[model samples]
Target: MIVHIIKKEIHFRIIKKLCVCFQLLLIVSCQTDDDNPTLPVEDSINGFWFSEELGYILEFTEGNDVVYNINTAGCSIVDDDFELEDFVPSLVSANDLILTTDLNESDFEFTRLSNQNPTCLPDQIADTDDPKVNFDHFWNIFNDYYAFFETRNVDWSQYESLRDQVTTDNFYDILEELVLLLEDGHVSIFDEENGIQIDSGFPKLLETFNMNLSGDFIIENGDDLGDLFGQKATTIVTEYLGGDFEIDERDNILWGLINDTVGYVNVLTMAGYGSDFSNELSTLNDLLDTIMNDISASGVSKLIIDIRFNGGGHDTAALDIVSRFMDQERFLYTKKFRLGNTFTEKRAVSVGPKGDFQFTGDIVLLTSPASISAADLFALCMKDLPYVTIVGENTAGAFSNVLSHTLPNGAEIGLSNEVYEDPQGVIFEAVGIGPDNQENRVPFLSTLDFEEGIDSGINRALELFSN
Candidate 1:
């Protein structure tokens, strides 16, 4: 009987080994071609790539410009001039050319551009298409072109696989994966028609709830919260939850009630100059009114200004906000950094010989992993003050701001044009500001308790002020 059992076990082991070998072979068969073909190095490129979507052919001239030649029913049309310096060849097949101005040439893939189908936009999305065949390509693009390339610290291979698996599951799932794939504040996916927005704000803010992106969050297992942002882990619980379930006009993400207190403000960019551009005077007027008339009357001594979602609006906003707190010139905090070859720009806050509203109370500003641009400037200005306490994780640290522009082919590129510094001659461009108190609510997951909760940074602010 023992001899018969041993023979049977050996046969089963052989079958298992064969199954493993077959799986390895199947994976290898599905891999993309890695062979780099040999080509004659050219001095310059002057050729065309076919686009079927816009019904035009884009050709490059040696004079550093791209011109569109319209083709209707395969017939030529009128010509329009364009610029192609930002046009990096999409390497798909063997037909794409990587044109370099400095006499360097490489070959990438070239696909006949498809017609601009509006339905392909994520909101109106329907079925599987060729472009949806891969998320790995987008991941590669993020690694190549993201603003904070070296600092993001993501595992490229894993992110690529994760996004690829969920691109077509549903609307919210795809967006959640995309945000995680590109966590940097500056990196965003935009739709041309709906405008560049993440949260579609429409429905009125609600009260007393737990919400997630997948839809109306169902409290499970005796009222225990399940998934939060994407399909990751169980949610952090909350007490007094209130907000709205609105869709932002931008058509990005679905907003639940828990998303109300966190306002959605996009800086759009942060590369301009001068004090007048920041619109600081206006923001301060509103803030001061909130503190004096609203908060003080409501018996609320503490205030939480959420700048974590801010994407660097203007430098003047930072300076103007700080000016409100500077009682003495010695107490003023100021710093400057060189902006390329132009005049050196002041990055911190100082006493501007003005006080919009002087309140002898404590202030706590909530920052996060995404607070950037002018908002970052504001947090840094209040970093050293006794009355002001910054709560949350470090700033987004996107110090080197960019001026971005779009190409005719719908590809957008940004150029980093300036440098900024913190007080005492310290440059904090790539490096962000660390909070006085490090507490945070992870994006898309933690339910914010307006009353009391461990993960609530706003509660931390109130705690600081109450003490």
Candidate 2:
């Protein structure tokens, strides 16, 4: 809604002075009317166009104008143009060239940019010579073809203008504005190539923060409920172990603490280490073995695993963890969605510790909205595990393993490529893993804002543990 212009100067050589002068004259010739604007008239647009993505300048010739020039393939001439009869009025106030053709008694709009500025002014007239005419023309075409016009409430003209000025750091703000225009949760901006990398679910990420286990367990340290849960779990594990437990700093894994009372394993992320970045199934198996040992020795009544900011990695680790809690070899949980009314089947089968490997004791887990990917895999897999309850908000639901590619014009599009389903075949595609016990923000702590009393999800899980 507000406009500001800052100028900077750069030095460059002047060449082909005659040709440049002649081109300027022709553009001036096409400026037939500044006043008494009525019927459409021929406009001239011939100049250099530059986009940061291409990292080069494009030259537009006066004759045989090319409407599109992909960075990799170079430029091409216009094959067809469409005219809009009543549509001309809508564009009259904006400074943009018009090119059109008639097809099936319908009108389409195009632009011829020669020497005009790419940014649109509220009431200013565009020059006849601008290369951005094609850009504007194609934008309008795509906007109509997709019919995704209600993406936002910002003025269309202003939106186009801001896009023309995409070099500024405020590009994120511009992208946010554009996202608001689409009004679709699936659509988001990804400008990694341009040094503006937006995450898969940035709209939500913008409002959330990721936290980890910080400092030693202390009741005096700022009423952090997360620390409280850890302290409680530690106390239970220590009592059963007889000897005190040790926090493994080498791996940040809390171990040597559960002496037959409960199994305590810390999962930093679903994604694993190394360049290949795969989950370490063997490591997970060893942790499960420790838990199984604890339960067997001390008749441990509960197991607690913490999951926070786990963006998911290997599927095998998920199976390993769930196998320790289940009694059967195969069980049902969920299904996944795919294109063409097709759904996939998912079965949770235990490959390790055959026969009576299931833990009858209560299963408790910690979570946050940031727990996504294969982390979702773990939560979803255990939704029905014996006595298993999750404490946290619904996950990011950014599943459906999607692939992303960029358009020739630098637009990025993401399409779902992989489908993830629960054992019974219920796919949680767009549906995130909702906690069995929901956690809302904590109040009076004034530190946390809750729609209900004290982090409902955490409190519910604590209540379950207390009972």
Candidate 3:
């Protein structure tokens, strides 16, 4: 007799909002009874299943409940116990059980364990509230899942010696020091109760150039650029570009025609486009449509996309912006997760033209050490396009989807777990994308110096168009 499995319904809305990763298991309750219930021929699902990728364990109980534990360290474990009801499981093989979850349309194949219980589950790190335990937990998470230890040149094992020295008073400071060692703009530690959060490393990198490329600096100095360029430039009001979307004129974006032939758009940040990711993408698309439409209609022969100080936001936003310049679908990049000691297969990420308008003119993308995360990703995608030339400094090379995890001590930690590569299979995590032409390169923030008022990167771009 064939046994059909029924799954419990779970809403995707709640799942999407969850801070936790979706490595869930769906189990069916064992049924026995007055009316007689049918069961699968094999009851091999009752055992321990471990996921080294996520550092979690699942204990399938005889009563049909699963004990979920997030094991960051050998001693520490975060327990999240839940009961699975109204679901059926099928035996795909002697040791493989196929668990299906409803509504979310997700399924996982669990291999039955020969051992009933694992030895690692016993030591639950009793006092997770202890500062030492929390510190150890934080360090262990990175030791296990962080993919860039060698790339960042971090000696993670040495942190074990500091565990005993960390106290409640110095926990935050020590943790910040440890996190900063990664030198990743995407790595951060937040303890709201303790009023501690690690600042992005991108800004510190900007200081090396003796300039400030932040949005505030740009707005403060943008109006004065016309005086610097003299007859070569004109500062047009942002409203003249014609977009219905509301953006902070001071920071979000700045647009105008240069020399009556080149169109310039400086995108400050990928965030603040909207409240959520979807809305942010929609708002960005609308903003780009308006800005690109204006530039295309003006018959500009060249375009410059300035992201020198952009810190980044959603990757979807990056793809959306790049799509506006593409006339056809283009392969952008690929992403892969680390499974055990090795990485999983690469998944291709592509972008195609969006909306009715497209920019086909020669494009120059400006970069700096401050151009980070999604901003760096934007440079990566645009680098593949024939018309786009990258100028300015190398980007802030933190390019991965940030995964946020909450420790038992209530401190939040974010790190990059996935690896992103270009179509050529080249990874640009620590080393950012290089400029095609390195002429007249100015420090990112030095553009604010209207007295000198000269941007080597911009000048190089202007020269390219002039030739």
Q: Candidate 1, TM-score vs. the true structure?
A: 0.40
Better of 1 and 3 by TM-score: 3
Once superposed on the true structure, which residue ranges of model 1 sit more than 4 Å away at CA?
Answer: 1-183, 187-304, 308-312, 329-353, 408-410, 429-431, 437-455, 465-467
Task: Score each candidate by Cα lDDT.
Answer: 0.36, 0.39, 0.60
Shift of residue 440 alpha carbon in model 1, Å:
8.9
Clashes of each: 18, 40, 4
Q: Candidate 1's residue-wise lDDT over 224-304, tens digit each?
A: 221221121111112212322222222111222222222211121222122332332454445444434433344443344
For candidate 2, the lDDT comes to 0.39
Model 1 Cα RMSD, 1 decimal:
20.6
Model 3: pairs clashing at backbone N, Cα or C within 3 Å: 28-87, 211-445, 212-445, 440-456
lDDT of 1 at 232: 16
Question: Of the candidates shown, which would achieve the greatest lDDT relative to the real structure?
Answer: 3
Better of 2 and 3 by lDDT: 3
lDDT for residue 127 in candidate 3, whole number 0-100? 38
Q: By TM-score, rank the candidates, best first.
A: 3, 2, 1
Lowest-sum lDDT 10-residue window in model 3: 6-15
Off by over 4 Å in 3: 1-69, 74-127, 200-203, 211-251, 447-450
